[model samples]
Target: MIHSVLESVMTANGIHSINRLHRLFFKLFAWGIMGFVCAQTAYAVPVDTKSYDPASGVVVKIAGKTLVMGWDTPEGSTELTLNLSGKGALVRSITVAPGNGKPVEVLRDIDPVTILTVGQRDLKKRGGWTIFFDRTSRKPSESGPLTLKLKSAIVRSVGRRCIVELDGLEGQSFSGKLRFTLYAG
Candidate 1:
């Protein structure tokens, strides 16, 4: 019966010692399991997600920041390479309109441009590093309306998906929704 009500509340507090009331009930059950594992790890582990595959990749939101690139993308000399393996400068952004309506500027920095490298300098502010998509997109257009800047630079192919909400830089705000694959060489 709860050990006779913990031996009548340890003999009215004088503590008659049943191993000091079982070490004060195992130190209040180890401080209630360390306060429930520090309140389940003190927040910041809620992720909220959804996915359907499509080669699985795309989540770039800058200004606050959040990038999880990987849509298995790769195409050059025409452009369409957003591999971010370079860690992408963290959104310095010469220009990026993930909304995909258009404005996908930053048509340079494909890693110091090799193949005998002939005259290449301007990397458009070097934002986030290596993010191709500019040869004027060769063709394929008709999903215009999320909004992009840099004279309406367009990049969409294979199966499009771009969602944007970027404002400011290095303060911490994010709204990203992006899927990948665009090749127009």
Candidate 2:
């Protein structure tokens, strides 16, 4: 029945040759298939959403700047206090560089009289996270590029600030940069 109807429509349009009719039928079938494919693709929905992982890192700030240590005079010693805030993060290690020079394991003066001590202050509470310089003490005898092991449960939320003190340098001039890394696990 559909074939008869198609034949009648072709006849009404003055189409008589079977070759022209076959060509027209195939063209219409191709166009219908192309339209269906385009429509399906245009309205297709994603099977699943793309997954992503959150960024992880510790943030260190010193008066809102990365470079915090500096000396103004040639005789007096300078002290630097840095604010560290991280979520379940701890200080893995702290290193010091002498202005484009190699990093030293210990921060010692040329005269062997000056000493460096690194300490930590809770800043808000007590009996919280503490900074340990060496294996058995809170304030390590030496300094410079030392890995101060942090108690795993340290820095619960707001965290604490590192207090560094330079002593015994009565008449010396120094300039350097300190680099510290924090890790969250």
Q: Which structure among the candidates has the greatest lDDT?
A: 1
Worst 10 residues of 2 by lDDT: 44-53
Estimated TM-score per prediction? 0.27, 0.20
Tens digit of per-residue lDDT, candidate 2, span 88-144 = 222222344455555433432111222345544443343344423223354334354
lDDT of 2 at 166: 20
- Cα displacement (angstroms), candidate 1, residue 112, comes to 25
- CA lDDT, every prediction? 0.36, 0.35
Tens-place lDDT per residue, model 1, 21-81, is: 7888899999999999876644221222332233323433221223332232333122233
> Could you tell me the lDDT of residue 140 within candidate 2?
37
